[model samples]
Target: MAGPRHVRPGPMVEAWLIEAMERYNEESLERREAYAAQVHLPGAVLQDLVWWALQALPDEILVGLDVDGSQAHQPDVEAAFAGEAHRDGLFAGQGFVISEAAVVNRGDSYSVHHLPEDWTDDLFRSDRGNRGGRFTHWLHTHPNAPAVPSGADADAAQETLGVDMILGLRFSPEGPLPWFDDVDGTRRTLAAPEQPRRFGRRGPPVLGVAPSGHRIHEIQLIAFHRTGLGVNVVLVDDEGWPYGWSQD
Candidate 1:
């Protein structure tokens, strides 16, 4: 019989995974019905945009959108940090871009120019430019799969995406919902207060909820790599994964 080999995971990795798993189980609960709350951002409506964007693009690719507004609104302070981990960067020629949940695009191409000028121009032009995107975050479908990020997802998220990532699960009985920030090496589950399952004319919307049970609507997850200049948005999926013409 061969002796047991030593397999060790770094302390940091172990800690992060523990944290993520704790979050996952803690937030896990019976699917319920709740109200949708809206969040206002500068470039464009991120939350609402994400819902439609995910539906349109069902495959795995980062996204970038041009959100040009006469004015930028005051960012939500608390909400900003909720899933910040999932917001990571990819090391392309340019600097880093935030990678949110996985992005799913059906058959349409969108441009991203609404991000902060410093972020888009400078970072996108940097060595890690491939990481940044004007798009919000990444999103993908599990195909009636689990709501958890897979080993491949975890790897891509850490190396490719460069930040925390969100996973969207497509359950048949329902449509699609999202889970965020398992990149710390741990699996953290995000959710709202448990409510009685309510079937509506439409399916569930991918968004965050407030303490008041209001869904943070019209919000989109954008990723920006840490640059001396500022954060830049990358043109990738909400999950911060790579994207190409041939990719999904």
Candidate 2:
């Protein structure tokens, strides 16, 4: 008898596979968060980062940033305020700035592959050192996808003690907008998580009418600690003015 023929997955099977993968990724995220560390980022930095990520839309890209902050059992309002007052308190407890971003060349269709080990080393060596804030975060874009961690993402994140962030981008005829989220490597809990309006879901049903008018493009942002703690993300303009929340 001939061997069984190879068959492609049908739509239903494909959907099931996608759902299964999503569930697996979510569970993996939960496991990683259980031991993740906490991080705080400025709204302005986030805004700029997302905008940059969106520019790479239809293709994924990698970004690196220097993080400045000290560990704290709880968020220190004074430290945060002091940092803001001096513009140098980012090294203070629970206060951070995601600064000095550099876009990594990942070639075309980069999403299908991981960063080369040599490239990762080079990025860190060139972008971080004793001269400035340490390379503390790895951010990437997920065009037209939810701001959720993937299995591959989880695996790569294991290589760092720093935070891993994902910027989700979905474009409308209006323009390119993106959402951001983080995956913790230390598994520590965060004190606050930003909440923002979501777009991208289908419009509400109406009798004899299409819901095109109700359709809205959305951008979502979130952050999580290794211990499954959600971190708040504040989106701001270049000058630090509030733009929106990252969670709900």
Candidate 3:
């Protein structure tokens, strides 16, 4: 009988994953829910990268990359973080990474600042020439908010065919109750309600509350396309094990 294979991620990647998972495991339910709302990807590797970036940086960050597999691509989709700027920002500006080592010029806010037409053209050309893959996805962080798309996010998605991801992270000392088996003996945790409890045009808040005296933090990840497609991101460790939350 053959033994299970062990795949090793890079040193930096492994370090980041470990730190991110440590923080995630210690976070409160509100934080986990925030993470659940926005982060999704096709594989554990990508998810780990997203988680690491979200936890390590204090402000917003961005990662751009190309996909290396098909839906037929199977259980594994290789996210080739091949460009130099596989990670960028905690910066004041926004723009795609076009070269192996492109650095976004400094701007002044969480939102991506506008770039000159000529500068953008040059970067686009560089990306096309040096980076062998198309810029297929962009992941960013939201310091202390829900993972839901903002008006600006929506508008930006319209300009590209790629998916946009947001990771919402806010930390607090309070925590939620630990998961326990259901009384029904189903061995499952509680399920979310299927229908609204009250009658109103807008749906009730999907967010959950912590028990009295318990503190909370917020972490969420969500992805959307301009065409209205939503992607679910699952966080995992370097070895592809699920973390913090369950896929089910």
Q: What is the C-alpha RMSD of each candidate to the true structure, in Å?
A: 18.3, 15.9, 15.2
Please give, for residues 70-157, the per-residue lDDT of candidate 1 as tens digits: 2232233213322323222232322222212222233211221122333346546444443355343333333223334555443333
Misplaced by over 4 Å in model 1 are 1-46, 64-147, 158-164, 170-192, 196-248
Candidate 2 lDDT over 127-232, as tens digits, reads: 3321122245666766555667677666555543455666654444323333223533322211112334358644321111112221223434445433333444
Q: After superposition, how far is residue 225 of candidate 2 from its true place, in Å?
A: 3.9
TM-scores for every candidate against the unseen true structure: 0.30, 0.47, 0.42
By TM-score, the best candidate is: 2
Model 3 Cα lDDT, one tens digit per residue, 173-224: 2123232212221010111234656666442333232322212233455555
Overall local distance difference test of candidate 1: 0.29
Candidate 2 Cα errors over 4 Å, as ranges: 1-38, 69-95, 107-113, 116-134, 173-216, 226-229, 235-248
TM-score, structure 2 vs. true: 0.47
Candidate 1 is scored at a TM of 0.30
Angstrom error at residue 203, model 3:
27
Computed on alpha carbons, the lDDT of every model, listed in order, comes to 0.29, 0.40, 0.36
